[model samples]
Target: EAGVVQSPRYKIIEKKQPVAFWCNPISGHNTLYWYLQNLGQGPELLIRYENEEAVDDSQLPKDRFSAERLKGVDSTLKIQPAELGDSAVYLCASSLRTSVAGELFFGEGSRLTVL
Candidate 1:
């Protein structure tokens, strides 16, 4: 089986611009996750979807960010009017199921640079 796949490994935009990222999780994986990582810090969960349902998204900044996992296969994350502080690495991951210690396979990530 293949691992998660993400497009546009990197992106650069000026503040107040919009950007989007795409991800394709492994087949048969029912759980998908998006994470944001800042320099020198651990990755923080942005949103988690079980199939087409977004089960957890408290950490996601809804004001300027949005995500959708259409049909529970491919997903897209978008940020509008991005701010300078929004620069970070956006990661996509997936697993067969959710568990306290379940292993996750992560993609190379989409690095965003807000100028």
Candidate 2:
């Protein structure tokens, strides 16, 4: 099966501008997730999708961030009016199930820098 794919591997934007990132999960996987990882820290879940349903998104900053998993195959994460604190690695991961211990395969991530 193909691995998760992400684009732009890096980005730089001014604070208050809008930025978007993309992800494509592994084939045949039913669970997908978006995570934010700051330097020297572990990845924190931003949103999760079980197929097309967004199962968990409590960690997402709804005021400036939004996401969608249309058709349950691919996903997009958008940050509008970006803030300096939003500069981090936006990683996309996928798994076969929603189990807490399920292993998530991660993409290289889109690294964002907000100036």
lDDT of each: 0.95, 0.95
lDDT of 2 by residue, 1-115 (tens): 6789999899999999999999999999899999999999999999999999999999999999999998999999999999999999999999999776688999999999999
TM-score for each of the candidates: 0.96, 0.96
> Which digits, one per residue and each the tens of the lDDT, describe model 1 over residues 1-115?
7889998899999999999999999999889999999999999999999999999999999999999998999999999989999999999999989966589999999999999
How well does candidate 1 match the true structure in TM-score terms?
A: 0.96
The regions of model 2 sitting more than 4 angstroms off are: none
Q: For model 2, what is the alpha-carbon lDDT of residue 19?
A: 99
**Relative to the unseen true structure, what is the C-alpha lDDT of residue 41 in candidate 1, on a scale of 0 to 100?**
98
Off by over 4 Å in 1: 99-101
**Each model's Cα RMSD:** 1.0, 1.1
